[model samples]
Target: MVTPTLALLHTSPVHVPVFEGLRDQDHPGFALRHLVHEDLLARARAEGPEAVADDIQELLVRTVAEGAGVVLCTCSTIGAVAEARAAAVGVPLVRVDRPMAAEAVAAGRSVAVVATLESTLGPTRVLVEEEAARAGRPVDVTTVLVEGAWERFEAGDREGHTRLIVDAVDALEGVDSVVLAQASMADAADRATLPVPVVSSPRPGLRAAVLRCAEGVKS
Candidate 1:
């Protein structure tokens, strides 16, 4: 039986509370189920995306099979892998970065995809370009990996991670919009005082997931 709950697949434990807060603020009483597999990202980082493809596919299929009408992949590193299994999973699925990428491409011709991990950069950049193509908006996508930021994030220095990301955003000179590749970087969006818009995944992605669940949309 398909439930009304919105299922979220994450690569980090941090997103549990983050999305919980967003849901609490935006959609009180909305049912949510989160599944985190940090090892998928770690192995992908050490090896490559292919290293975790099977794991991501299985996890995604399992998430939907467990009665999730809608599933959202919150990690950009393995987002494409998860989305690829959507057809086989047979449900409304969303990659967190897609909505943010679409917004970034629409905001300007030059979109900068910022990530703390190098593995996240390529997928995110491609996602931005894909969104641009879908919107018929030509975009110059640039991938920027903020050095040393991931260390801070992994070390549990949340403030340091946000500070580095915010600094990176502030340092960017010529960009139509900045897309935060990982949902963990959402805090930096508010911390950034850039002239150009700073896009983050959690808000728009969760909103899209909630809407999908409400309308029973299949994507």
Candidate 2:
């Protein structure tokens, strides 16, 4: 309560506990708040990510007005919009998958981007490429869309979702590193004992936001 200093905007309520657990384990004593906007992602999926730009911007600016020093957008479908408008939102807004994408591109030139949602895959792939461009590295990104995984997640079958994701990650033929596009798929990716490194968003993303909060850096 106390109007958390750090806030997370999420599309799925499931991410609340996932991030909370991370806060507890990694950033103890950090005040965190979670705001779920299921309809935003639903509309994005039905239409496209651009459809929810205004909604994301408005909601986040309001969150800053309420007292959150840092805002973390955890939905990949609309993450670009959130990050793009963070300065306008009046706070340091972190797009969760960006750090992971940057890390993936840094790990190697051959990057594998994996996602369960069609809405997520494209943006994540582009993000990795942009990171590569920023680093001036030539990257070959392979996008792996795990079939039927989102259905399992929507059905509240987390184990099934994780199982499918893990299996797909296992079968990846050639990639220097794997980037799990959705934070939801990260657990399964972590389960793999891959020769290549697997990067996921939540941990590095929150750490970056927390650092911004500590340094009093405003976006």
Candidate 3:
């Protein structure tokens, strides 16, 4: 039987396809379960960020217990909480941006994080700062939120959203390279607007998880 590899997708419905893309890879058998963050996000936005951590912890435990060989959260915004949950779950819980952030820190001294959501940008900035600090490099971090991209994405305008995000990223004045804060934004990395390197989370995390899952199944 194929082991289940649960993917707790973020609040954005847009991430569904991105996770689908990850599963589409020609790896051995695996199953993905998407747990939307919409409700959590709505509550956090309406109420506050205080409650989402508990919600994530609860969801992480539930998903892992459902025979999930490993759990992965697709949102970069909740890295710290996700890390904590992963530790609590006592199973592999891959935070989407951890692998990518590690790569970015190794590549250069200055990093630019391109994200549309304000919530995501904050966590991503912290991750970059922490990574650079550990690397002992003088890091310059810049965050650019793609104006109106998320709204257009929800309206089912993929092309328009892509264009808007690419435009916003292009507008980021300076940096060594840019990291797409969300997996859904990976497509933007292919665009020619970014003269520097573009790092993406989904691919790296997917590859790592897939390899680890395969190892687990073998043992």
Candidate 4:
């Protein structure tokens, strides 16, 4: 049965609380839970993408059984695995980009995908292309990876994290909009004052999932 709320199946530890913050405001009915991926992500980086997919599959199977309405994976590194897990489950599973990418396409014909993690770029590109196709619009998606930002966040340096993202995004010469790949990156958006629109997963993803649940209830 489809519940009135959706569960954010987090892939990274940082994403867990970020989504919780969203529920505090925009989505009170939504809940967030996570599966461990630090070790799993490390293994995938050392091994290959297939290895990551296998671990994600196990986590999704367990999370789905726990009565989750939708499984939204937070990390873009394992997006391919996230898609596979979605296919494996009978419920709606959402990747973080599905909404942001769509928003990017809607915002402008050119979109810049900004991420501090190199691992997230591949999936971000795939998501941009997919969303563009669905919108029947051609878009230019540029991916930029900023180093040390993620480390700063891990070390509890919020100011450092904010500075790094603003500086990196400032370098992008011309883009209609910017889409931040991870939930941690959302904090940087408030600090950035760019000529283009800034899109992040936490807001758009939660809004989409909540609306999906709402629509299901009305149906």
Candidate 5:
């Protein structure tokens, strides 16, 4: 029996450890490979989503060519574009926050999507709505951008970034669940002391990717 390799596409290097930890603990049998496009997010933010579509598509192609059983895009900002290019890659491509979105939609009627970057807000909200439609449920999705949090993250002030996200989670009212839109914000979900259930991408997303890899191998 051969173990399938799972490739993780990341826009930020910060997520490397998060997923690595999860894989080590839960799916140690599967091999993990990471391709980090550290500047991809900045390009998306400056030039808009369409500008990065080609780059994302090319990356997915490369990942598949490298023998990845499945590729998981870890950036919410580029998730939609990745999905658009999935057919071209001819591999199982997943968005890290996808599982979180489905969970959020199923967990409650009203869900709040909290993100540190404005670029993530739109894509994350769209994911939630799409999940709701797939589940045949009507969900009210709200987007919240934590001001100054991205700057803190860019400056390597993870503590500050997590603090802001925690505050945002605390402030979300009348929501049944809060979805942390970025993989980097997974730490915030752990730190948050909130009334509503707070969800993040790392664990659930990686688990799904591992399962996909297993399915591919079995097939």
Candidate 6:
């Protein structure tokens, strides 16, 4: 019998280590695979979400065909498209931010979403609101984009990228919790000196993905 694989769909190479570390620490026995589409985000930003929906769907289908028992989309900007594709492909697809969003909404009435990318800001806010609605809780959501951080990340200056995110968290006020919108920003959550909880996507999201895959295997 073949081992089931947990596939990760990533827009940036930075997530490779992040998820690998999570799997090593918490899910050592699970098979892992990565599909990095570096240009997917650029295309989504230039042509809109619908423009790249088909390509994402095709990738998800291929991942499952290649033995992925489940897939996780690490890019918040393309998460909605990934969900639709996951349904069509008949495999469980997890959006990295959903677990964080659900926790953020449950943790506070007022939530702040901080992202380095403009494309992530809207979708993350929408996700938080959706989760709040599902829980029958009312939430006030705010979004912040840390300027120039993504460029620093692109240049491989992770410290600078993290510093900008930490600074953004420092600037937020009256928020019950601050949600870091990307898996790449997870480290910033640890470094933040905020009075409220600072949540990032990677750890909780990976935990959920692993659980889903395990449950699927059992069934």
Residue 183 shift from truth in candidate 3, angstroms: 1.9
Looking at model 1, residue 166 earns an lDDT score of 98
Clashing pairs in model 5, backbone N/Cα/C closer than 3 A:
none
Candidate 2 lDDT score relative to the true structure? 0.88
lDDT of 6 by residue, 1-219 (tens): 444678999998878988898899988867779889988999998887778999998888877888888898999999988887788768689988899999999898999999999988988999999999999999999999999999999999999999999998998889999999988889899899989989999999989888888778688
Error of 3 at 156 (Å): 1.6
Off by over 4 Å in 2: 1-4, 88-90, 217-219
Candidate 2, residues 1-219, lDDT tens digits: the string is 232488999999999999999999999988998999999989999999888888888888889899888899999988987888777656578899888888898889999988999888899988999999999999999989999999999999999999998888988977899999998887886698778988889899988888878766433
lDDT (CA) per prediction: 0.88, 0.88, 0.75, 0.76, 0.88, 0.89
Off by over 4 Å in 5: none
So what's the TM-score on candidate 3?
Answer: 0.86
Worst 10 residues of 5 by lDDT: 85-94
* Residue 182, model 4, lDDT: 74
Query: Which residue pairs show backbone clashes in model 3?
Result: none
Q: Estimate each model's TM-score.
A: 0.95, 0.94, 0.86, 0.89, 0.96, 0.97
| Clashes found in each candidate (C-alpha, N, C closer than 3 A) | 0, 0, 0, 0, 0, 0
Tens-place lDDT digits, model 1, residues 75-121: 89988877886766575688888989888888899889999999999
Per-residue lDDT for 71 in model 5?
91
Per-candidate alpha-carbon RMSD to the true structure? 1.9, 2.3, 2.4, 2.2, 1.1, 1.2
Query: What would the per-residue lDDT of candidate 3 be over residues 1-219, giving only the tens digit for each residue?
Result: 465565654777777767776678744355667777777766655665555888878877777777777777777766667777669768677777877887787777778888877778878888888878877877778778888887887788888878887887777765777888877778787883767778888888777776767777777
Off by over 4 Å in 1: 1-3, 217-219
For candidate 6, list the clashing residue pairs, or say none.
none
Best model number under lDDT = 6
- TM-score of candidate 2 on Cα atoms, chains taken together: 0.94
- The C-alpha stretches of model 6 lying farther than 4 A from their native spots are 1-3
